[model samples]
Target: MTTPARLSAPAVATPVPWPDDSVSVLRNRPVRLGTDPASLSRFGDDDWNIRPAHRDAHTTICNLNLRVFPEPLRRQFRAVLLAALDHPQPVEPGGRQRSAEYIGIGSMPVLARGLQLFAHWMHLQGVRQIADITDHDLDVYLQHITGTTTPLRQQANTLNSVRTLWLFRDVLPASCRLAAQFPWPGRTANELVGLRTSNGENKRPRIQDDTMEALLAWSLHMVEEIGPDIRDAWQEYTLLCRGEHSSQAIYVGTAGPRLRAYVDQCRRTCTPLPGIPGPDGPRINYGHVLRLIGLDGKGAFSPAQKRWLAGQGLPVAEHSTVGVITGQIQGRPWRDTPLAIGELSGLWRRLAGALFTVVCYLSGMRPGEVLSLRRGCCDTDEATGQLVMHGHRGKGYDRAPDTPDAAEPTRPWVVVGVVHEAIALLESLHDQPHLFPAQLRVGMFRPSATHARTCSSVNRDIADFAAWVNQTFRRADGSAPIPDDPAGNLNASRFRRTLARFIVRRPRGLIAAALQYGHVDTKVTLNYAGAPDTEWLQDVAVEKLELVLEQISDDAQRLAAGEHVSGPSADEYRRRVVGSADFPGRTVISPRSAERLLGSTDPQVHHGEGMTCVWRPETAACRAARLAQGLPEPAGPDERECRSTCTNLAFTDRDITRRKQDLHDLKATASDPLAPRPLRDRAAAQAERIASLVHRHEQHRNEGAPA
Candidate 1:
């Protein structure tokens, strides 16, 4: 292949007015700017903590460190970043201005990182001024980034920063403006980087069935059973921290009598002193002993009391303070050892992760939306008694360039009762306004910091939870409770896709499905899934289409295996299935391709509990009912209104077998002397109808056989 021509700079344009270095890029979020913007020297300062007030505490403060770049490139880098900060929706040369809202303050760190990479590349090339960088240099930088192990998404973002420089050229100072146009004209950064455009397919892998089940089950266990114990322990720990009962005089005057009485009661009741696991074996938990007697300090036991306890076969250790652990799993203690004060923080995090898993998987809310939830966000509708959550929709909001407080509008999500339990657990875990706080306790960072948890931290929480479960909990056979999924570590984003899969597949005996769908009616689930803000309804549609295709392929296999198919649409079903012999099972197909195939075949097939619907919409019996209800004509069969005598009914051998079993059960009920006369009559009539249907099915099957 011939070498492409080197890119050269285009004509320089007149510079626009540059904002003072002291002006903040963030529009209205002043409190979180950390330092006075007027005092900030963009060139002199190496670090600028410009984290937006609205951002989560887990999000690192945005620091545009100019020190990392070569000295010669710092000014240009600052210019590009400031332009990005000031004019986020800058127009491209000879292109229409973007109509989308300006980039928020939260995006500055990402934009800075991308620009930093570009500046570094320019530095290495010994190109100081933006005007001197040629098209070849841009091409080489692109090649370098693409060749790295960095993900395609990040690479696209990095290249887009370079394009941003060109887009914002008019806003930059003359010395910092790029003379050359962006080398790849009429091509998007994603296209240039070879990243495929999204075809409406959710690329996130679904958590495996077994792994999801165990994870959710353990999560529920944590929220319902263990959470209360943790809360009680936290309260006790907090009280101990207050130093109200730590006076030596108080212990000598009142605690001595309480301690003696407690010991005597334990001896009389034959109750063993609370113990914690030790190197030798179980040892006395002195912390519990102190708390039981209303004593505050450890080592408050007098020498005489210690001797008395030793005589009673209970000995206090020097530094043992195992707090109470009352939670149980599978009728056994959930923890073998008492929870230590030091370990409470970690356990709280694990508990938070468990609650996070339950909420994300059950509510089908985005992780950010869930993280944004505050105390009292969830409530029961007094009239309907339906549990609903009201929280900010984190995505797709329009903000004016000058509006600093453009808050996200509150949107409602229909959720199950278990979600209410999870929310309650979260509320008790911390005092932060947001349900999922960035920190469960005051740590080495700011003691007063109060922001929502970050998505990355939530992902880590999920992975750690799975690991913790495997190490801490066990099944009846002593195997790990949470099995490893082939799809790798669970994250917040995958749960929605998993939920969609569950709703579509309706797997037998799946607890998640039962918890998610069974407690609520179809309308509630649909309200949650079909909300215009969510992609879940589309996800369901995609899953349903994939399921239909799989069913068609399976039906084709059964037909080839000599299974008889009998119904009003039997021949049509066979023709469609056989014609779709080219259907690729489980192979990745683009959405457009799936749509085209679906349109071409027009099978309109939907599998139900005991029959398959090969629906012809024009002649469908359900169409009349839909029209009567003032609903639009359905694109597929309405399984709820499925009729036995409808011409759309297609029966396979499996359906026939199920029908025969039903007929036998009906006959048994009809002959029962104990059954009410009305019930017997109805059962007998149903049995006769089913028997007639079976006879006709068999007769048709035999007649269609070799003759």
Candidate 2:
């Protein structure tokens, strides 16, 4: 094929030409640009109408120096690279904005490197032309990527890059295009890599329950101290900035008397202070002014502030410059209380971060979604009375500005009361609508790419908060300080997965409960919690049921072998349920057949830790839940509330084994010479009850079994 004319004009024009200085510079390398044969022949001879987004891709290609390859190879390589760039990947589209989806700018370098690697490999194999490359050649490249000692993740990346470039098989020379018998299967990168458990879903650590409780206690206390009054102060501060007034409080030191006279003179003449600070860069040291007014720290003060402060055990130093009179000297042990801030400005900034931590942990929103939230984003739903958070989705957003999508990518998330309070607190801190603004500059705590922090900043703040809690908090009785989590691995992303685990582990934590957390189905929750699928949880429940059955089977087998049995119900259970025709198998049961394995009349299996409830709801001994509430469903026995005397309770093999040991100990106690008559009688009675309970379980299991 012959080389065609220059590629057609793109959608947007650029003054710079392709193959500028970069192509010229590459000529000094081992390879030189081949004589122009046909770079665009494999692609159609039509003009290229590059979209505005593709301008970057075009620039990457130009810089890559496509001319370095031999004429035919160069032509094939140019067609594939251009094609990959031409079709941008579309973001998942929803909302008002039509997002322009394209391949990432970073991937251009990877694609270029991949092509170079393939070319080098082909050269080593002594294959001169693109036509000669075949399935076997691709296999060699795959093997190269998955070298004997290469890390699994690295190998996966290399294989993916090769696969990405190879996708333009249709555009390649007829001989060079991949065939039906291609070496690598067109499966996902994970499948192709064949690495077990590479997803790292289980790697994130959950915050310990006790540690979470402690952190929450500290956070709530901090919120209570600064939340309401600081919000009002910030609002007034913002108003003052916008109004026509020099808001800088006069800094009067030795010149206080002179300044007061000058201020009075200037006020009469209606003159302004020289170089009054603008709102953006206010010259006023508000921190110093706050100190003067006796409002520097978090606590409230009386109207007769000086007298009140002195009377309240705060002794003023005679020569102290700061206006507020406090016994709190600068050098002292850090007391375990609300932080004493000398400057009030820093208090609100840190408070915003603390509020952010509580909101993210409680709401279960992704870090990006929470960070993207603006002021007034929190609203009560009129229909449901639920508090909802509105923010742009960070993922799946289009880069194009001109696309006819909605101006605002607002999404609503249902949040709890704490999150609502946090948002309200944030709104009071700044006039700007950013819910989590930071001090980028003096008097400018507004949202900007530089100032408005992301997840990294949030994580840092969370870590700092954890450290602060450990340092400042002590037990109410003042015994020992709260210990830090040993791992100290807390982060924002892990909170969702941790919450999912907690719900799954709870009693009656079914799909209905899972629905309230993330707006996802049972299957999604299962996957998030690292379970195989929806059936995985059910399978675990069924396995516990089988374990109890197996224990019963083992006991029956021992009794049949003429082994000694001491429990009151041990012999009864062995003869009735374990030896009955209704006895279940000890083998492993898959989730699919679990339902059919146990019928309603069969041994009722409610597996709890170290215990099982062979409950018959109709005859349930503990009816507190169902009886008083008039609930439609039967009130099953609570495992924790289960009494030894309850008829519905069933002991597992391990429990039965322990019961025998307990009976022997009680019998020994009854026979002891040191025992009183009343103690002996009580011991003897307890022994009989243990044996009777064991026998009762066997009879119950037998009754439930198929007759």
Candidate 3:
């Protein structure tokens, strides 16, 4: 923190050599430089090799012109500005060879602006050279930059940028360079002191379980209805495009006699077939009818035939061509036909949109990963009958192998049953490289696979589907329709968080617990077991565990402040967390730390299936665990152990609500006349236990209520 001498206007000024065209770049623009414009004519040089043609660079130079300083000082400032304008070094080694230097790039404007601010501050303090700055001056400059509301990280970035000004030492005069010293040591933004803040992790919104269920239910139904229709339409179009006209016209067996009857009727009455629209009017040409059955060469329909066809509600045409159906044409090439094409295309879009929702939500894959999925990515596990999907990591491509032509790394996803069904439906729609092919608005066939729909499109499809369901569907009783989310936001990324929350709350030994999450690598793991693209699941799990601990601590404090808590383990929980000297305030305990400390001391906290356990090992009341071990430490409650009689069990608000629900259901069971006597008595006892706990908790809360 050495102080340098104050500076004043220098005795002699040196001429600055700059390009003649530099004035043309800034003369018309109203760029602010925070200093006098006359000061700029002193020091720019033509020797500066950086681009004067680029917009950002040009503007920066123009703004730099306004910072009026002595010639020597301006030279050091210009050198620092040029250095900071250089392109960033490539981060990945594999792409380094392909990288090119960018012109008019980098944060030149930001650098210029910071320099201008620093110059103004320096001007106010009468500091003209780098050597004149002191540690106290640097401290005051930082204080001025970082306002009361400025985020610590942003403040750190600004300070880090200012640190680069020290590089001007190389360009300074010998006397100035010798006296110049940076107040703070150069360090990374993260490593710098005062940048650290206790701001909590960002929490994204997750779709509620009930809302997710409703969405899936609607999507599943839509898939069932339209999936088969789309598949059939595509199949027929394929057959027709290949010119299988005769086979497409009729079905064999019992329909042969019926077909003959229809043809014979058409021949006898000289009428047109039903469901076909004609040129101008709703009637058929007899000559055209005869030509369809190989009678007339001209293929003309008579007035009698037109009248008969019109009576049957079929449109008549003057001549026979490709579109005119003379028989049952279920398998006909109908892609070229307008009506069939429209119906099929609409169905296909709906099917793709619905399938996208099911796949992304159930698999919990990111939208980018889902979009990257190819046609054959989904497959069945032969032995276990589980659905597995393969997709590559989209965001962390830098983790890929550094080879000349390295393939993008892939991962597998263990998907649920409904997702597998959706994949199957998508596959049935068409045979294409991409699962969701790019389709033209009017065509039945896919256009190309080169450009797949992006995540923005995926999000649009989700919102559109939600809107469609809300508008089109109704409850069976017609009492209440499925409501949209109050927030009116349904994003594709939210599905990952929704699924993670769903998995974490599932019961022990469920599919979630059995599954492993985190990045999967190696051929065997990718082919058989899925590796998650990220460790977000683990992070979320840790966050949830910490949340549970925090909730317990809050409850303990409430109990200490004369608030009531009426679980079997409430008293013990209070003693451990609230009464303990180390347990104070809102503290976050790491998952690893909690795992190490759990059940280690007296009145220990134990995580179980239904409730938390806080009990003395010797006096543990969990009958199943106690009987098996006959000791408190080893006799932790089993998943199936009695929650009612266990003295170590504690309840939070959600748990209390669950308890009330249990009480209600048990009362309903006990009041049933059909229930056996033993069953009724058991139900009554369980209900009474829950009721007592609820009553005690309510009474405590009422006693502690502010009056």
lDDT of each: 0.69, 0.48, 0.52
Question: Per-residue lDDT of 521-572 in model 2, one digit per residue for the tens?
Answer: 3323432222223432443334334444554565457545644432223334
Measured with C-alpha atoms, the lDDT of residue 161 in candidate 2 is: 58
lDDT assessment of candidate 3: 0.52
In candidate 3 the C-alpha lDDT for residue 699 amounts to 75
Number of clashing pairs, model 1?
A: 4
Best by TM-score: 1
Lowest lDDT 10-residue stretch of candidate 3: 51-60
lDDT of model 2 at position 241: 37
Per-candidate clashes, comma-separated: 4, 13, 13
Candidate 1, 507: how far from true, in Å? Answer: 4.8
lDDT of 3 by residue, 176-272 (tens): 3314344344444444446655444435677776777787776776565545555665565544444353543443333234345546555677654
Q: Rank the candidates by lDDT, best first.
A: 1, 3, 2
Native-vs-model 2 lDDT? 0.48
Q: Report the C-alpha lDDT of model 1 over 448-556, residue by residue, as the tens digit.
A: 2445678888888888888988897667899999999898888888898787777867752122232333333354444454245536655654565666676667877
Ranking by TM-score: 1, 3, 2
Q: Which stretches of candidate 3 lie over 4 Å from their true place?
A: 1-204, 208-211, 224-226, 233-247, 250-341, 379-386, 399-409, 440-451, 476-482, 486-488, 504-532, 538-568, 576-612, 615-647, 650-707
Can you give the lDDT of residue 298 in candidate 3? 27
Alpha-carbon lDDT of model 1: 0.69
